[model samples]
Target chain A: MVFNYPNGKKYIPAAKIEAAPKIKKQKNAAYSNRGMTLEEDLNDSNSFYLDRNIAVIHKKPTPVQIVNVDYPRRSAAVIKEAYFKQASTTDYNGVYKGKYIDFEAKETKFSTSFPLKNFHEHQIVHMKAVLEQGGICFVILRFSTEEEIYLLEASYLLSFWERMISGGRKSITKEEVIECGHKIPLGFHPRIDYIKVIDYLYKLS
Target chain B: MVFNYPNGKKYIPAAKIEAAPKIKKQKNAAYSNRGMTLEEDLNDSNSFYLDRNIAVIHKKPTPVQIVNVDYPRRSAAVIKEAYFKQASTTDYNGVYKGKYIDFEAKETKFSTSFPLKNFHEHQIVHMKAVLEQGGICFVILRFSTEEEIYLLEASYLLSFWERMISGGRKSITKEEVIECGHKIPLGFHPRIDYIKVIDYLYKLS
Candidate 1:
């Protein structure tokens, strides 16, 4: 999936531009072996939540800018020309126990640190806006190499983002993530049981 | 703009498929006269609210399923083939004062009643889920002919939808809407000024 800014510049994520590890090959192999990506697992878990009346969360649709569309008389309209517009917000959001929940999910090959560049400038702005409105916002980071998943609050991520902007660390170390974030145990029925961590973190029940 | 179901059926809006007045030309004229659509006005209002540190609301991007892409040498990747997918949920959603806000906006030429078919089945189901989760869910109906706008709670909408499904009135009478819904006064800085109505209806100070 190629995403472009409104100005038509191709967005090359920093994680993808790295040279050391063969992430692409591993990504393909992971798909074959695991049979799902973090996004797919999250989507599945969200549906499980919905079915059980636990929460109402969904992945926002990928943003696309349609340029030219063709209406073939007897068939559905077809988009002939379009560009992938960059998203201005996080990927998933919904109402959880009467509280607004917003978050983004990302997986990295690194075992020690999660790079900050995996997120865009607009997404941070969006997270700040959500936090200001008193909504619960966070990021779910998966260290593929270590097979560990952690949920880090957006406030901590925002501080790190500020540090990065001021010429500090470009990545959040695993130790820092461990200190500030909560680990979510993977499960079968709901796949990644993130709501449990949320419940515990917020003392919702 | 043409939208389609994931099953490939073209979605002709209930308002557009109706006969009598040429809604397309008037829709185009509306864009020319007001210098915006309802979506545009709400977007402007949301930005105004954002700049003033009031609330955070946004219209989700149009959903599209990409079928083919062209990554020509040095140029940005272009979507060569795609199809618009029917949205599985309402359009605008966000957080306001620690509460989840979810709603859809529709402008109709009808002056007497608002057609039930203006909404899709999936949207109604999604609205039910939000309501069950204790989220603020409502519909903003713009009666273009009367130059009036009303915010009808999702519960009223669900009842009317049930009536429609059980061979009752296919639309909600304007009188019923006036009795059950809150009238939102049009504004300058915030455009539609719907949040004020939200504040009043929800009794949030």
Candidate 2:
């Protein structure tokens, strides 16, 4: 279950399975014929960019809250108790083509719409802040069932976020996304060629 | 004892004391009447800038390698085993005045020179990556005994770093830093006025 705070930060307080099992599930899914999940593809693409000196982007490490730790004589410090912490910002951020790029990636099984609940109020607030700072900010939407992906500008998402708060539709229609967002064609070397789309939109040469 | 990896990342493998004690030491150091240490003062300054909407900079959370975690019914997932992981990049990064700002802050007790040991090889590489991308990258050097702070650009530090590897002096003399870096005057609210120096260097209005 998701426990959301007033500021729109949701905390998943309990785990149905252990950490290793959870990771194993992801690994199995990653090996599926679909190449890899959008997240893994993005990570691999970022690594590819880094190795080639094309760009420097990294997924921020998962935030964890430590409660207890044990210091063994000659081994690594063992964390005895900790909890996952809600992140205050988006997942990906770095420099590309002399500009700061910030984005979030989300995948939905639904065919017709991207659920608004996938994003949080705080994330929208963060995107706005990045925009105000003149940073390039956006969200990558992946329709897993259809194997399609689109990059939507933060400004467009912000309007929809505000509208949802004011009693509008709970999700953005697939048609709306297709109209406003750039379609990122998947490829081999850099599986998700989102940078090409960024250059097109921002005119960064 | 600090465990130094060949790549220059230091791992505090064993905690001499509990996590609370570790934080307490930092807190006590932060409460000095003369002025907070460079790290504390910078944290305060960042908070000031954040509250005033002047900038959005943040220290990355310490990286941890989680080995085991426990799930209690209706409660948070507790990490049972983990180790502190070495960070690949600098401590602080964020948006400032429509530019990407990335930096690491370090203080030296030595009065004569800033030792090269304070910085890691990987950090130098990370700084260089940021620089190549046209990001504003630098290191804030605090001569603690002298109660002076200087903003040294990554390029300047990179030169010294390369010199050290080529059998030069193991440190950068105070005179050299003074010659190449900008002095940041301490203030009340924000404490360290480093952004003023950035504005001067970058000619950002």
Highest DockQ: which candidate? 1
Could you tell me how far off, in angstroms, the CA of residue B149 lies in candidate 2 after the best superposition? 1.8
Reported per model, the fraction of native interface contacts reproduced equals: 0.55, 0.35
**Candidate 1 similarity to native, TM-score:** 0.86
By DockQ thresholds, what CAPRI class is model 2? acceptable
Error of 2 at A64 (Å): 1.7
Q: Write model 1 residue lDDT over B1-205, tens digit each, in one string.
A: 2221222122334454242223333564544466566777788898898888899898888777666667675336676766667788899999999999999998778889999889998899999999999999999998876678899999999999999999999999999999999998888998889889888888886
**What lDDT tens digits, residue by residue, belong to model 2 across residues A66-122?**
656666653445566666666667888888866888899988878999999999777
TM-score of chain B of 1: 0.85
How much is the lDDT of residue B137 in candidate 2?
93
DockQ of each: 0.32, 0.27
Worst 10 residues of 1 chain B by lDDT: B1-10
TM-score of 2: 0.85
Model 2, position B176, has a per-residue lDDT of 97
